[model samples]
Target: MRGLRKYLTPFAPDQSGAVSVLYELGGIIVICDAGGCTGNVCGFDEPRWFERKSAVFSAGLRDMDAILGRDDRLVAKLVDAADKIDANFAAIVGTPVPAVIGTDYQALKRMCEKKTDLPILAIDTDGMELYDKGEEKSVSCIIYCICKGKI
Candidate 1:
């Protein structure tokens, strides 16, 4: 605990912030968690789920999926959802699960981009970070992918 503080940050997790920024952006926002993160977003963080219509979903990652680093399966699921939904882009918002597993969001973005026509915004947001950080991340992703044509 050399550099660790006793108190946790006074901000919400990045997943909540990521979803907030993209909630009305007309794209599919996927929470890369088993279910807890997504539940937090809908049940607590974002109460607008009842009023606003966003294509937010959970990757529904299972135990072995994370253990085996099943990036392909996630990419496939994203692409399939993009095909069915009329979305301009797709966002993969990371949580503690992917963070612990060392998920490479850039590679996932590339994989999703190759398979789907929609632009993919992969925000590698671990649940430990503040909500504003995730908001900044999602905005940065837009700038990097759209402004710089990384898409």
Candidate 2:
């Protein structure tokens, strides 16, 4: 396995300002929630964190949409919002409900990318894992993939 240094170097001290730089360049980071919940993982009440850090776009899914497996609306909303925001990349975060419906996030990602000319990331946050565990696993996976040149 490669050392952590290889992956961490891409996001080092100097590059710590990259996200803000991207933001200034009209890059966006959308956080999708089908569960109608909009708050930080740490329960911070500040909205500016998301606004200042990245262009955060949200899509709250409806119960009917969940039951019928009709994620087209959500995808359309995301694509439209991303286009309007002129985002360079989008990150779609799933909730428990959408996971239960088994929405094809990969397909959604492709669709969104096609429509908006932006890379899309799908994050699955449902079932047996706690939030911290899910976050750790996601970060580890991203790191490993980056080190392997898969991202």
Candidate 3:
């Protein structure tokens, strides 16, 4: 059967929603993708993106980095960005690339902590799911981090 949704595209994924959850918080939001996911979140998914300012960024994950599990490189980039910006915390929102590679978010958070004093907020999201799933995970993680005194 021919698809009738030529004018439409895939709905906003969980990754973008995860970023949106932290939009108001004064923290560095890092979208763990090659690049486009951040654009989508800021340009399309996030309605308040234009009206407000946040420290959202992309990890710029390359194919080799994902395949080889070069998490130290990611930690370096996060530390560099954090150094340049004033943030109270840091949130790592995962995408399909990291999910496929089984990125260890807990380890990443620990490495980031060693590099910087900012608390780490992890949103475990894979691009395959819907927006609500990511938002839910993000909220849950934030609550968990807060209760555990990690954030």
- TM-score (all chains, Cα) for each model: 0.90, 0.61, 0.90
lDDT of each: 0.88, 0.52, 0.88
Candidate 1 residue-wise lDDT, 1-151, digit = tens: 6997685533478889988988998999999999988988887888899887688899999999999998898988888898899998899999998898899998998899999988889898998888898899988988887787755
| Candidate 3, residue 57: how far the Cα is off, in Å | 0.4
Lowest lDDT sum, 10 consecutive residues, model 1, at 4-13
Better of 2 and 3 by lDDT: 3
| TM-score of structure candidate 1 | 0.90
Between candidates 1 and 2, the one scoring higher on TM-score is 1
Superposition error at 62 for model 1 (Å): 0.7
- Can you tell me which runs of candidate 2 are displaced by over 4 Å? 1-30, 40-53, 140-151
lDDT, model 3: 0.88
Q: How many clashes would you count in candidate 1?
A: 0
Residue 141 of model 1 has an lDDT of 88
Candidate 2 structure quality by residue, lDDT tens digits, 68-137: 8676777788777775775655666555556667877778777776776666655555533444444554
To one decimal, what is the Cα RMSD in angstroms of model 1 from the true structure?
A: 2.6
